[model samples]
Target: MSKRMNSGASQQFVIIGSGQAGGWAARTLREGGFEGRIVIVGEESHPPYERPPLSKAVLTAQKPAESCYLWSKEKLGELNIDAVQGNRATAIHRDRREVELADGSRVPYDRLLIATGARPRRLNCPGADLPGVHYLRTIEDSERIRGSLSKGGRLLVVGGGWIGLEVAASAVSMGVPVTLVEATDRLCGRSLPESLGRFFMDLHLRHGVDIQLNANLTRLEGNGRVERAVFGNGEAIEIATAVVGIGVVPNTELAADCGLPLENGIVVNESACTADPCIFAAGDVASQPSSWLNGRVRFESWKNAQDHGVLAASAMLGGDALTRDIPWFWSDQYDVNFQLLGVPSVGNQVYQKGDTSSGRFTQYFVQANRLTAVAAVNSPRDLRDAKRSMQNKSQFDTTGLVPVLTL
Candidate 1:
């Protein structure tokens, strides 16, 4: 076993939660020429893996979970970093500069990075404790869901967001009867525009996925296992299984217990540092302040998490000051590819550059006659250009944007 401490008072870097952010931080430390005792503590038994495929390819059994791992065990060994997996960081004693583990061990550190990610929000309705009810978050969760889906049984999907829709699409492709319920008036209401939302609504409906909008699920009725769901609209539907994809709640209990100021997530400055200079945070768990968006936004996207990891690592290494790029996200549902850049808040004037009726187009959100954000469906070329335009905050001729689409 490698000694935890080296000669002299070399810096001890401890990272909690071995997700994207934590993994990146460790890698960055080595790459940045930091010769310190680096240790990563993760609660999961497996190493940090990519999560975007959880609801898509992995759930469909098209790809194995091991393929999603970003770093190999050999790679970590080569980097000379210690990864303590399957151990939870129970508490942090900032005054003593030590992190307490659930196994009754304490690791002293000179600096700490918190990368605890988010968890799927559980359904609070009655009978939510049934056996057949599932939530997608980890590889284990996805494995169980894949088994349930193999039964070729009725699937009741709760929520209309990306995860729910992606799972619904996968289940439908497998010939499983799926009924998706959303509490909102449209699908992806918080992220997508009405036109794009309607386009997806039509696409799903045409593919035999029964979608119920404005549906408030009252309870899940079953005999020790999920059997049916009763809605507030006084309608009941028999279901073999129920999958909840409502949203996520940041795993900030440790930070909150330590009296860290948390608004939606762990509050961090542009450098991804907390109020204390010795501690930092990133990924979905970090509510980083964005200078580009002119507000503090906790974005739930793969790109954001990866970007945050890089930025936080750079900041920790005392590199150039961190800068927030335009937030971006992508989703693959059925045959359509949706990409969004920047924050598309409500009341932004949307300028359509292509055919929305045909469901292949790009919509640019213009505020003050400047392209602030964009959403593209089946239009990757436009998405790339729009991303550049959004970064520059430049104006483009609407007619010209339509012609230059082959990038």
Candidate 2:
């Protein structure tokens, strides 16, 4: 209804998934002066909200669920955007240029953006569907896990990834004992380097967390809820509550059903355009070619969600946002603020500017004398300093009274 266009025709933009990507896309469209009918379909009850805090702040009771909100319902109305909450998009009728909803209504769209995001990967073992088995992806999930922690029982965290480590840290902050198990030999094998995993292991161990490596959780046992965990080695641990932080699976069934290409996620170009020119994809559900990583990747991070959503919307508005910026990710656990930038590979030469024993250091991943990636723990300033080397083919400046480790 807000007409900024000079054309005689009206264009409608519809976005699926009312999460970070969807919300930002809606805002970016209005900001770009796309005077058209914008409709956002959300499966959740709340408007688009941040999820990074759900593991740490919300789980530890440091912040309320309201703190995660990005935009309120009234804000969407102010932008003249129709945000349909508590409803899901059932199908996309591409032939009709319409999206069929669960409520049996079809919304016609001139162009569509699918930011469906992803769902937590569930375990296939027995007793996984029990009431006490929790997954942290939403505000309600965080609150439910927090409630379980407050009940005064030992919490078993499966998978030693970011989510698992954060949940363990949150439990420790609340005086709840935690036992973390990782199927691999080290923690965060997929996201972090092997050397960095040792630092995280030591950090959790210092906080009295029972961490088990090269461990596999075979099944959960309880009367009506999760009470015990059975490992692969026939060892069992008494756990009152369980939090599974394995990973996430992209929601690509919708795109797949509509006959779109899928490779790990919805395949998109650098401009976030899919196989169909009229439809685009972004955020966790989109597998786009990354200029930073030099490969097609589906990044599930807050940085990617915000940046990619903006890029998609910009491209939709006839603007050029055909780029994947350098990957940036951060996590907060207990007193640590760990940040990771760029991709870390085994071939990169690892270097550190500060002692790991001090619990604050910056690690650089160098390739051919050029810094390609950086990982910092509690050293935001040092991390920012290392970023310049990522562009220049120069050695890291480790001058003056500092400990440097080259591995």
Runs in model 1 lying further than 4 Å from the true structure? 1-9, 400-407
Compose the digit string of candidate 1's lDDT tens values, residues 1-89. Answer: 11222222388888898877778877887777778788999999988777888888998888999877878889889988898999999
lDDT of 2: 0.86
Error of 1 at 264 (Å): 1.5
**After superposition, candidate 2 runs with Cα above 4 Å error:** 1-9, 391-407
Q: What is the lDDT of residue 243 in candidate 1?
A: 91
Clash count list over all predictions: 0, 0
Per-model lDDT: 0.84, 0.86
Error of 2 at 68 (Å): 0.7
Model 1: per-residue Cα lDDT at residue 377: 89
Give the winner by lDDT. 2
* lDDT: worst 10-residue window of model 2: 1-10
